[model samples]
Target: MIRRIAATLSALALTLCLGVALWLNDWIDETEIPPLVLETGVEVLDRDGALLRAYTVENGRWRLPVSYDAVDPSFIEMLVAYEDRRFWSHPGIDLRAFARAVWQRLTSGRIVSGGSTLTMQVARLLEDSGTGAWGGKIRQIRLALALERQMTKEEILTLYFHLAPYGGNIEGIRAASLTWFGVEPRRLTAAQSALLVAIPQAPNSRRPDRFAEAAEIARNRVLSRAVTFTDLTEQDVDWARNEPIPTERRDFPALAAHLSDRALADRPTQATHFLTIDVVLQARMEHLARRATTGLGPQISAAIMVMDHQTGEILASVGSPDYTDHPRTGFVDMTQAVRSPGSTLKPLIYGLAFDAGLIHPQTLVADRPISIAGYAPQNFDEVFRGEVTAAEALQASLNIPAVNLLSALGPHRMLSAMGRADMEVSLPMDEAPGLAIALGGLGTRMDDLMRLYGGLARGGIAPPMHWRAGEAPGDGQRILSPVAAWYVADILGDVTPPPNAPRIGLAFKTGTSYGHRDAWAFGFDGRHVVGIWMGRADGASVPGAFGADLSAPLLFEAFSRIGDRPTLRPGPPPGALTLLNADLPDPLRRFDPQGGSNGPPQPSITFPPEGAVLAYQPDLPVIARVAEGTPPFTWLWNGAPIAIGDRDREVILGDIGLGFGELTVIDATGQAGTRQIEIAD
Candidate 1:
């Protein structure tokens, strides 16, 4: 009877203990685990994953996310050694450490160490629970066990690396490293690693920026302990102790400021953004822009853009000289602003003419003073070259030959070509397309011109430029035939560089807008295209600021900084003809509006005699008589075509404006004559 009672009591006790243990397990399982998702700031990185800029998180904290792989091995080893020596072997709690802490407290009447494992610390950090209370400690132990079950050791350590505070409003190893050391934590010195390990214990009191001495003391303690626990030797620790701790926080990288702002504004919820810009190139370009604009004027500003024409990737873009300078209105992005293109559009005009088979490079064209419709355009020096080859006229940027070519090609056709190339040009509202468009009487942005030039560089196919990484390139539009494109590049490649500038073998053009409001230089090599602009931000004229003087030198300097010799120019295309004036076809030898016909005598404008001054009247019609050779004629007022296919010898010139005007008549046989007259009020 005694043996039976004993067995039954033992069985009851065992069942009760089993029930209690099951209840404890259930209670632990029901513990509320806070969300493990961490909120971090947005980071803008270059193509190579270099940080270009960073934005603060909510509550104005400089907390960037870090991973186990991004940290240095030394830092991890020291951190594990100093915080939880047996972190790899412990399940959640270290009973040996706990027992030692209790024994020390009983002997000394004071608590020596907390004996909390790294997992327990992570649990407390995750919940933001205080360590002074028994309830919080017990809760941490439970949560630590749960965390160890759910996450790997590396993951828990990464959480600690991210959540551990360094100083005021700064969290994570990345933030601390960038703030104090001005570099990533991927590679750190022994001192830097030790300092990072010491900061979490007393973040506020031992901040190196505020209390360097205190921080050094804490750091030395870790290093001394590291001698035993880590691979660091006494010599390494001694060397690290001699190194100076950073006393002030560093500013995060602010390269590509405008682009960063744009990226952030574009996707506010994104944690990180990757762009195609090269940080090194971007920095160099920004420096170049600042140097170019300094001492010009307080209001003067500059912009630059560099791209790979083949792939249409923007490698570097400097929007303004200084983004913080309010006097220059640096907040504006000039690359996207619509301004006059001036002679920058000349190459395109010449290219189109070549494509239309209207003129060869060696074709003779007249650049004498002439008027079209009512507009009289002149060369930059107000001089005239009576006759010049098409190549010479373009090389000198003479206005008359370009206008003549545009007159033949029609302005609307050129615009259509641009549209086909995916370039948008803005003309004045309610104005008909006219010959003045040939000499930059329209508005276009720098980016659009880069695309156009990039097309020229890529054998006439213009690829759309992009900034975002991994963006698929679109099928480019054909702006010119391969032959015509080659011709343009060949001519531009020989353009003379500015004084004192190296001959970098670049095919480039420079343009100064009317009134010197905007100066532009667009250039390309075998693989790249770069555009530069300099002027006042407010659109005010910069006196004597010519593109050749202001922007051309900067363009060359930019190429030099790009640090690659210009690639070799491509060979001529199959259909491209290389001919001299004497060896050319009759029609291709001279630019003739009458199809190279020589049958009729040259026409003359007889009614408006040379240097004749006529009275100006609003609605008066002046009769123009042509004396000589052909039955049908084309007459131009100013440089604009007024009448075509006129069978009569006399045509009425109606509403001639009050000014010096030119009357030109082209006969059916490709012979022409002109008369300069004045209509005075």
Candidate 2:
């Protein structure tokens, strides 16, 4: 009878064992291992991956993504030593520590150490819990074993490093390091490492930002015990023990806050978005801009944009001086905001004129008061520099000269040229391109202005600016010939720098919009192009916000910070002449307001006068006649010289095409006139 009972018990035990094995297999298959979705805060890094700015997660936590390799070795060692000494070899649980704890609890009739391994803690965090309840503990033990099978020890450690909370809605060593000590975890000191290791045990009660005494005690515990696992000497532990806990949390780096916010909004799903910004340069310029806006009138703000001249990549883009200052409307991004460009467009006008061989830098031009069809322009100082070289007129920013040059290089054509180079020149509502655009009569963003100046730095090729990695740097469009571009750069480089500032190789220009609503300073050198704007966001005029006074100094100061002194003095381009006034031809000495040369008014097409497009007719003559100026003229069809057949007063073309064409008439005195016409075949 005893034998029969034993056989029955053995059969029952075998059946129970089979059932438990089957249940374990089913649980393993049904359990969906979480993806370890570490939703860290959005981070904007510089070109070299330096942190520029970080935005808090939706839970208001400053959790930054970190890897095992990114942390200090001593911190990891201390963490393992304090939390789970057998983390490297153990599959999930330390049986020896668990047995010791169980024995101590049974003997004392009270709870002792919990004996939780790092992997088990990671499993609990993954399931979003930290309760030490028996049921939760059992579930975490199973999950920890499962996690060990799936992920290596290093990966589980990485999970622990990132998901482990330090204190007060801040997670990960990176965030805690930045918050408590104002440094990166990669450069953590011995004391800083010990503090970080102790925080995760009781993050809230021992938060360094709040409970200083509790934090110091926790830090000392870790330091005293760290020598067992880490390579820290007793001297190191003693030194770290004396280190004071941080009393207050330090603010995270907010170098490019506005840009980082925009990047976050633009790339919503991304946890990390790296920009092309140089964080060091960006911080310096932002500080400078912030300081400059301090003494200015109320509601005033400043913005700056720095670009790589060669690649057209944005190195720094400060949208506003203080992003959180509500009085200044600092939330508004002024770098991409449309505002009047003022006299900054003047240099492009002269550059275009030079490219067309219509004017030289040394060519004489009148800055005297002039009017055309009831529109007259004056100099900025209201005192014209009469009979000055083209370069001098530009340096003085004479409005009359710019208008005259724009008139010669038709406004519509000038706008078209800029458009071809990927620049957007915003015009007034429903208005055609006019000479007033030479002044601040139109709107343009600071970014577009920087790109245009960057083009000048790149020999008149305007390429699109890059702000993100992996973007292709496309070939730019030619806006001006090399000679013309060099000429403009040379003239701008001659401007006097501010007091005590060395002349960097930069060629800069300043512009103040109408009503003083916008102040701009755009500069470029062999390497960088920086543009700045200072004004109120509401378009309200500031009384003393002149571009030269307010923005120019900031521009030069930025150049000084970059340590770019005028090293490469760009020489004159081929086919460009640097002739003196006396060496210039008589006609080029002083511009004739009446015509291209020192002659009478330019001859006009009498029959098909201005704005005339004649239709092609086989029975009628395509007649052309000069209205005024010296006779004995030479006619040109399209752009080539054509025979006049001994006819000085008028000429007749036999045939014409079905498209648009230009007619040119040049007289013996070197004065010329052009008229556009369309002929329907």
Candidate 3:
């Protein structure tokens, strides 16, 4: 009779819970889960929906997808063992456990125990619980009925995985995996799985790290059940129980935040939208960036990007080295920093000038020192070259010539181009009055600079920069005439120094900002163009850190090691214009710096000068000159040796580097009178 009464009470409690759950379900509005907000405004993903990172939102509530592959099998085993052992046997609530629970409660003469099963737990979670005991019981019973009627055993477990709270604010396995283990649910190992399963019981109050020892106890329970019910072997349980779990992969939480701030510009939530990043290429880019940044001190940083010139897709982007694990790194993202682009902006001005029909590849310009009223434009050496074709001037990286071209174009044209390129600089329009535009006198960002050059690379059409895949791109304004674009490309291709490694064929340019505050190098082969701008985001100056010295090495190294990419025929320019080498009889090298290469003929000195010092005159430093000879050779000196084009020490006065050295001649016909010497005062 007592047992019958206990059974009756349990049945009555189950019936009450079931009715409440039905009432709540019918009363409540909806149950479908909402998505996590994209506070950063731009979403970065691999080509597929796999997430790379995200930014903070006002609510700080972001939800990632709960994939079917997400739950750890061990987690399932543990939940079944501890939450409801007879979960498969029961329709929803366990009638036997409920009866026993009622008898215990009655014997204790108070509410000492309350029986609950996974299905009832699911019900309470589906909606808010009422305050009174009767109300709570009704709610639980109603939810159990809902679960039993609406879901299969498999479906119940899946929903529970999604709705079950694991830790503070982490609603599902996917979120919990990222927060604690730094990996996706699919990536967690058995040990990690065990620890996660133990967390939901007392989430916020429990510290997985602090109670790692206690987590082991629960881990064993899951392992034992898994062995008996599943095909898992005893050895597997032993390993999980005894072997320490290797740490889960960590993420650069700070980087995500930083990328969030920058990538989340006008449209704050845009960062979470599907981005145009190619996961594979982004991986490749990250590897290359990390390798390059190795050994750089903590204060140092780097940003690199791989851009598809035609499509404007950012294939791979690494703003900082892999910091997914190091706790100390809660800082900067290299990708979106607003730093000076140094010479990376060179191509923009040059391309623009060419597009405007103001310049051509074969156009002759003087690479000589000239003083602009307020600013004196000089080459790197503060020297000058007499004249050179536009291609030669750019290839040699002559500063003066660029300033001259800028001067010729004037600042209005430059400002116009800058506007078209989307540069947000506060230029007075009067400051950049000359050819110095070729040297990137104005500051620019890595993103805009890359886009500007990409325009030139992709037939002079400005391809919009995007972080998401979309239906179709709107037309971009034509920034360059097809002929103008080809002219610059052809020039860059012809003038580029041979690649350090024959394996790499690149068409690129290098640039350095004034005072060496930034170093920039960018180039493209066929399919892709990469622009790298490196410097302290704080705008620190690193002397001698010119484009060739810093950014170029990385650019070259990447292309050299990246293996073969298919060649793209830039195709013929519009109007049937084609590339043809024009000898351009114009003078390209400067004739003077006093002792410059273009200096008129000088005298010769001799072996007497080996140790003997002649009276030194301050003005006319002793100069050795030679008569023009056959076959070219180098010359050395007592006064100052000159390279007499052929095998003689003819005074090409500026040939100072060959000072006090031997003259090597290739052709015969030696003439003693060929050499002349200007004795020291």
Candidate 4:
């Protein structure tokens, strides 16, 4: 009787356990989560859309966004080796293997040796993206069994291939392929495959820079797998080493970290994201920024942005001028750092006034040094042109005119305009002085400033700044008037550097921050608005260092590489160029209807085409119009004997000013065009 009773109780207990297990399984299967999405990358592109990057979830890790097939197989292999050794053989759950892992853990002091097969891992990745303890692990085991029953081995592997985490905020082999290998997973070679496969072991800890040995070891292990699976030897590996190692692997941590910070800003991984970036454009920007800062000094960082002016699509962002290729160095993002913008803000200030109808492109303002309640503003050089046109003030990057223009337009309005441009900086209406506003005293993100300039380039509509994946949650608002935008764009074009530059049909502005701590050059050509910001990480000053000297060349390199030329879309500006009431001061007072001072507000004899070439005699003055928001500029050639009076109008090749070499004008933030002149004196 006792034996029979015990047997019945055992059967009952078993039935109850089975019931509970089934119930939990049903619960887990039914548990639905809105897909893991990145808020910034919530924007979905069309088929073959030109998005420059992708963020995929792979095997339970968060990684960078990459191209669909961007990861190397090595990256994939790393997941297989570390997560599931019998990935090729196991159906999903290996009961015997799971038993062994349990025994090993019981005997050992570690929670190591998970016998989860590739199928189980894929299941875990799908169901468990947590950093918690036993709860996630128990769920993982149950899900693995369910997944094995639900999906074929091939299907599970396929899913695993797409969703494994390789690094920070980056998931899936696709993103790993792009972020680490800078290639597609489909195109991965055995060596490249090994590199990709190795990264996930400890994405952050086994950084290429910090743990080169470990990463290489992990790579070699994947290589060994591919080799052993076939008929290759260490000798083959020896032969392969002669081939090029991946340059991308060397830069992974930096790129991944940069994207991580950018991604976290918009939304958590659960929200939708749309990035205003094209993959090719983003890659191109990084390559160019790296090239530009190749020989620049140590501790110098730069932030670069390429935006579609109208769409506010940030096609590419390179936050670091060039990372030291060191893992720790990856911690600092040059693009996000707040630095003085100096003259880069000049164009925007002018744009603020132009947009408000408070100032005209032909507005005349005294360029001479001016004292504003003990805030004496001066030009980049100590001396200044007494009375100058707005255009000259911009081209010369004069401080006083910008301050004067800001003063005319209320400080509150100027800040408001910046806000409208998607700049995320605050100026307590009182602390943010109008007089020194042109000098770029406000602290702001480099990316923000780029978008602000993008507003001008896009013809007055300031599209909301976008990063990661999706379009702005809502359509953006127009910040500047269309006419105001056009006027600014036009003036920017007029003052653009000469025809000799490799880049053409581009509008740009350059700036220097206080104490020369930062140098910046940014602006838009027809298609892309690129902004570059350079500064010392420690906030050290660079004496005599200004944006024009340091940052313009970097802009040229990028523009030269970006093949497409953008043309201004047609639209009427605020005022006609009849030159009816344009105020021309002395030196410029003798305004040439075809030259400087005589160009704007005048329906003149001729308007040069967007990409025209000009030659000059040493003593002749040159003048042209750019976008209205752009400040007027002057050229002071020291040895060529060119002297542009403060009020001097027109670009001339002549004598050098008192303390400088051949001077060039950079409008907004972009490369300076080259103009050659035969000095007459």
Candidate 5:
């Protein structure tokens, strides 16, 4: 009876134990894996997938995503060899390693190793674990099994590669590689690879920048073990072991900061964005811009943009000399900031005139003092060339010639052309387009200027530039005739290079805005278009900072630094004319500003009617207008010519004598009109 009773109890206990095991198995199978929220920081990469800049996550962690291919093969072998020898063959749990750990701990009276696989570590990271020993280990084991079944080995490795901590705020091999060695993981040497593989085991202890001796010790440990599993020879292992640890972390490459910020702002939720920037070239150009700004004095900054003419890819865009420069307001992106373009827009005006058959490059133009209404435009040097060919006038950037052509072309039409070419020109509120726009009275962004120049480089077809991959190239808009574009490009190419610089053989133009507030240089080779701007963020005038003097040399330097110099001159299209002044047709020789056989209309004063008593203060503003006449009108007070400004429509007659005075206006065609007004004090 006793034997039968023991048998029954044993069976019952065995049955209960089996039932509990089955229940636990079902529970483990049904347990759902916690969702891994690897909220990586925003990363900006160059065209070649090189990191340009990275923003930390809200939690201040650098969790950049990584793929197996992005890491060195040797690093992977060393990692697996040292951490989990059975990683490839095991189904997440290595029975032999666990047994060895238990035996060694029991015999030595202390724990030697945890014996956790990479998959198990990943599972643990996915969970919020407590200090409970056996229970937590069992849970991790179960989760590891589930994960192994759900994910492939490569995926698990990728997770470990990205999630492993390397030091303070740094996670993943990619981040560590960049921070510790100033390079990508794929470019790591044997020493660098071993160092990265050993860091995650004790990240704080092995931080090369913080604990150099500890880091070296850990690196040597990995290197000693690497010879057993990796293809590295004994010599390789010895050299890597002897390699000194990095003493400092490096600054992340800060190329295209403003642009990257803009990209992030546009897609705030995205973790990564790729731009069209060539990081190598971008770095070189940024260095150049910074060096140039130092000599420009305090509070002055510079911006440059490079675009491929054929593909419309913006290869480089340096928004400022230094984005962190607080005194200079370097945070402001001048490339997108609207500022007066000065004489930079002259090339487009001449191109339009050529397309309209209004004039040719060699056409004669008068640069003498003249007025339209009361507005008078002056040259930068305050000296005018009497009779210059259209090409010469444009090459010299004479304000009078540009104003005359703008008056004939009509400001509305010129602005309309710019609009069609995907460039926006900012005008004063409630103001109509005027000839003043021809000489920097309007505002435009540097990007628009690049597009305009890029259009000229692209045989007169203007297309919007592409900044990111997969962006659709816009339809090409015909901004100028092929022949006309070629003519302008040819004229600009012949412009004298800045002193000591080679004739870049590029069609380039420079401009100085009114009050010397902005300097601009836009140039194009056969395959590229480059635009540069230098000025103060507050719009403060920097006297003597003219475009040709301050910005042109930098422009040439940038072109030379651009890798693989392109052909200097572009081939002329059909119907294009390459001729000297004497080879042009008679009608094309001298542009007829009147556009009629009859002489230009006599100038007349429309405001402050003749013989009217006008109340005026010496400092008060007064406007004088003419009913009909050609542009570049000149105003004389008592037969004396005053030094007027660059305008055609209206002139600001500053401080006319308080007594009765005679006002006379003369057009470029030599027609004159006079009026009399008495000022009441």
Candidate 6:
């Protein structure tokens, strides 16, 4: 009777256990598990994927997402060994570890060790549940099982890496590494790895920056257990124990502050932004800008930009000397600020003249004081460099010569060229373009000037610059002919460097705006171009502060920091001519604004009226006639000179091509007339 009763009770107990198991499975299935998608802060990276800046996430938390692969191998080993030795083999909960914990707790009458695997910790973090109660533990077990069913081991670990708390408002290994040690988590010393492993266990109490003693104790405990649990030697543990813990948190990287802010503002929903900036170079240049601006004045600020002319990539852009200087209005990005460009535009003016066959580099130009239409431009020093070569005039930055050249080239034409080069020029509110623009009458940004100079360096093709990595640059526009660009480069290369600056073969120019309000320096080699600006942010004059004295030295120092020798200037192009004033052709030898006609009628094309179309005849030649100006005249088909020093008022165009063309007549004086016509076959 007793054996039969025991058998019945055993059968009943088995049926009850089976029923409980089925109910538990149903309960686990019904439990809600949140999605594993973690939200992280926005990060700004440089060209090499180095962090330039980072913004806090919602609730102002510094939680940067890190993958399992980004974590150091040693750190992972230490973490797995210390947290869950059976992490890989266990389903979700380790029954052996649980039994050991229960036995120890029962014997000691208190908690000895908690049997929570890395997955259980990740589950707790995801649900923000606590482990102080049996209910929370059961919830974590269910969630852990569910998570394991859905995610791989690597994915679970990556989740832990992204969600693990380290200290106040800082989560994830990446945030911890950067905060405590100022580096990424890809490479960490044993001590740093141990410390990082320990912090997440009791993040608030073991914060290295707050509770150093607790942090050290926890870190050393992990190191002590590492001997048996990991491959660490006693010697390694000793060394790791002896290493000092960080006492304070470090501020995140804040290089390229203005640009980073702009990027974030431009794309608010983006989680990461990659720029074309080189962080190392950007850091060096920012420091240089700050150092250069020191002691200049309380309100003076500086801006700089460096670009690869060939690729039109902006390597570095320093918006201001200091981003926090309230007195200097440092928040303003001067690179984008519209300011007078001073005499920097002179090079372009001279280049246009060269392309027009008006003057060579060695051609003599008069720089005496002259007034035209009541607009008179004076040199910076109010001194004239009379009868100087065009090259000399440009090198010395004489205002009279540049104004004279611009007058001949026409301010409208100069503006058109700038437009073609993709530069945005701001003429003072609703004012017409004038000769004064040649001498800083117009306002332009530093970046636009960089494009202009970079174009000159790139053989006259101005490529649109881009700041974002992987962005395709726009098509380049022809600003000057290759020969004209070469001539300008050759002339600027001969400019004397500032004191103690070695000639690094850089072609550079300096300009001081009227009233000394702005100082500008722009330079280029065969490969790179850099531009600098220094002045009070409020546009107030700094008396006696000139570009030559202030900005040029900084420009040269920037090149030195770049650690690249200036590339050799290219050879002259096909039509380029290197000659002295005496050797140049008569009309090209001296710039005569009057065209040497002495008050005669302005030259005009009579036969080919403006916008006229003529039929093409194979055997018949087109007849071209010029109105009165001078007996000897130069006729041009399109821009190239076709008939030079012709004594007659009419010239035969036997060799002219049948197509749309421009007819131009130039008198002995600098006066010219042009007609656009097309010949059809």
Q: How does each model score on lDDT? A: 0.86, 0.80, 0.57, 0.57, 0.82, 0.87
TM-score of 6: 0.92
Superposed by TM-score, candidate 3 places the C-alpha of residue 238 at a distance from the truth, in angstroms, of 5.3
Worst 10 residues of 2 by lDDT: 638-647
lDDT of 5 by residue, 446-473 (tens): 9998888888887788956888865747
Greater TM-score among 1 and 6 belongs to: 6
**Candidate 3 lDDT by residue in tens digits, 294-366:** 6655444556667777777766666665545243142555555555555555555565445433344665656
Q: At residue 257, what lDDT does model 2 achieve? A: 83
Flag clash pairs in model 6: 594-669, 595-668, 595-669, 595-670, 596-669
**TM-score of model number 3:** 0.67
Which candidate would rank higher by TM-score, 3 or 6? 6
lDDT of 4 by residue, 140-212 (tens): 6666656665656656666666556565666666555655655546676666566666675566755554566
Model 2 C-alpha lDDT per residue in residues 1-681, reported as the tens digit of each score: 999999999999999999998998677556667887778888889989998888888679888888878988878888888889999999888999878878988999887776788998998889886566889888887888888888899999998878888888888889989999988888777899888988888899999768988889988888888877778999988888887889898888888888888888898888888888888889998999889898776599999998887777888889988888899999888997889999998888988776543466887888888888788877777897678889988887889988988887789867866775677777868988788999977888888888788878877788668888657468777776666788889999998876766776668899999888998999887788889899999889988788889999999888777754344646775445677877744334554555644547766777677667787888887888776757666565543335332236778766655565556665644355667677776
Error of 6 at 221 (Å): 1.3
TM-score of each: 0.83, 0.86, 0.67, 0.57, 0.84, 0.92
lDDT of 6 by residue, 67-122 (tens): 78899999999999999999999977888988898899999999899888899999
Q: Candidate 6: worst 10 consecutive residues by lDDT?
A: 593-602
Task: State how far residue 357 of model 4 sits from its true place (Å).
Answer: 5.7
Question: Which candidate has the highest TM-score of all?
Answer: 6
Candidate order by TM-score, decreasing, is 6, 2, 5, 1, 3, 4
User: Whose lDDT is higher: candidate 4's or candidate 6's?
Assistant: 6
RMSD of each: 11.6, 6.3, 17.3, 15.3, 12.9, 3.2
**Once all C-alphas are superposed, what RMSD does model 1 give against the true structure?**
11.6
Q: After superposition, how far is residue 356 of candidate 1 from its true place, in Å?
A: 1.0
The parts of candidate 1 lying over 4 Å away from their true place are 1-20, 102-111, 564-566, 592-681
